[model samples]
Target: MSVELNHTIVHCRDNRESAEFLAHILGLSTGDEWGPFIPLVLANGVTLDFATIPAGSITVQHYAFLVSEAEFDTAFSRIEERGITYWADPHRKLPGRINHNDGGRGVYFPDPSGHGMELITRPYGGWPEGSPVVPGS
Candidate 1:
C-alpha cells in the first residue's frame, strides 16, 4: 500500500483567518467545511485542517513546504508583496532575505498563528553550484 499524508489539525485562534492566511500563502483556496473545521487542500491533496480554539490556548508548530525553484520564486514574491518578514535562516538571524542552500533558494517566515512556515528547494547537505549558504554556515 502506498501511504500518503492526508491532513492534520492546526489549532488556531481563528480557524477561518488561519485557513485564509495559509490559503493565500500557498496560492490555494479556503476549502469548504469538513465537519467542524475549515480546510485548505493543497494540490498534492494534503489538507490543512484549521480549528478554532480559545485565545492564548494555541501552541506554535512548524510546517515546511518543499517547493520547486519556480514555486519558490512565486511564493517568495507573494511573501514580499504582503510585506511579511522573511528570514534566510531558521533562527531568524538574517532577516528579510532568502537563502541559496543546496543550490536552491529557501526562506522562512511565521504564519498568523505563529507557526513556523518554511519554503525550501533543497533539504540539506550538498548542493549544486552557486548554492547560497544556509545562514550561519
Candidate 2:
C-alpha cells in the first residue's frame, strides 16, 4: 500500500566477503547464497544483495545505519578490534575518533569495497532542544 525499499544491489569486489563483513558488524547472519548475490537482510526487512563486479566498475557508496546505543557500543568495539580506521566526521579530519552529534555517538568507516559505512545512535534531525545542528557529523 505504501512505497518501501525492498532490496538494493551493492557492487563489491567479492560478494561473500562484503556480506560477511557487514553481517559480523551488524551482528546478523547472511541469507543463503543465490546466483551472483550474497544477501544480508536487515531487521527492517531491507535486503542488501552484494554482487561481485570489477573493482574499476564499482562506485563506492555511502550507507548510514541508525543503531541503538548498545548496538553502537558493540559495533564500535568490533571496529577497533579489527583495527579499522574511523573518523568522527565525514570529512575525516578527526581520525580514530567518534562523533557525539545530536547527543548520540557516531562513526564513519570504510568497508572492504571502499563504501563509506556510517553508524549513528541518533538521527540528524533528532537533536535535543538547544543543541546546535551539526552538519556532516
Candidate 3:
C-alpha cells in the first residue's frame, strides 16, 4: 500500500562485530545471524544487515539516529566508558565534545567499519511544535 525501507546491507570487515558494536551502543538487541548477515533492527522495523566484505571495499557511510534524551545519555555514557573519541561536528572539527544543536544533544563517532555514526536527541532542525516526527514515516 505504501513504500517503506525494509532493510539495508552494510559492508564491514566483520559482520558480527560490527553489528554487535552498533546494537550495544544504541541499546538494541542483535538479531540472529541469517546466512552471512548479522542484523540489528531499529525501533522503526528497519534492519541493518551487516555483511563481511573485503577490506577497503566499502566507502564510509553516515548513519544518524534520532534517540530519546534518556537513550542519548545511556549511549553517550557507553561511548565515554569505552574511550571512543567523538566530535561535536560531522566534519570532526571540534574533537572530544558533543554538540547541542536544535536544543538537543548529539555526538558523532565511528563504528568498527569506519562508518560515521551519530546519535541525537532531536531531529535535524528540530520537529515542529505540537507535532511529532515518526520514525520511518
Q: What TM-score against the true fold does each predicted structure earn? A: 0.85, 0.90, 0.89
Worst 10 residues of 3 by lDDT: 128-137
> Model 1 over residues 76-122: C-alpha lDDT tens digits?
87888888988887878788778887676788898888888998887
lDDT of 1: 0.82
Q: CA lDDT, every prediction?
A: 0.82, 0.87, 0.85
Q: Which parts of model 1 are misplaced by more than 4 Å?
A: 126-137
List, residue by residue over 86-129, the lDDT tens digit for candidate 2.
Answer: 88777777787787876788899999999999999989865344
Error of 2 at 112 (Å): 0.5
Task: Give a tens-digit lDDT track for model 3, residues 1-137.
Answer: 79999999999999999999999899998999999999999999999999999987988899999999999989988888898888877888677878777777778999998999999888878434433222211
Output the number of the lDDT-best candidate. Answer: 2
Clashes of 1: 1
Better of 2 and 3 by TM-score: 2
lDDT sort, best first: 2, 3, 1
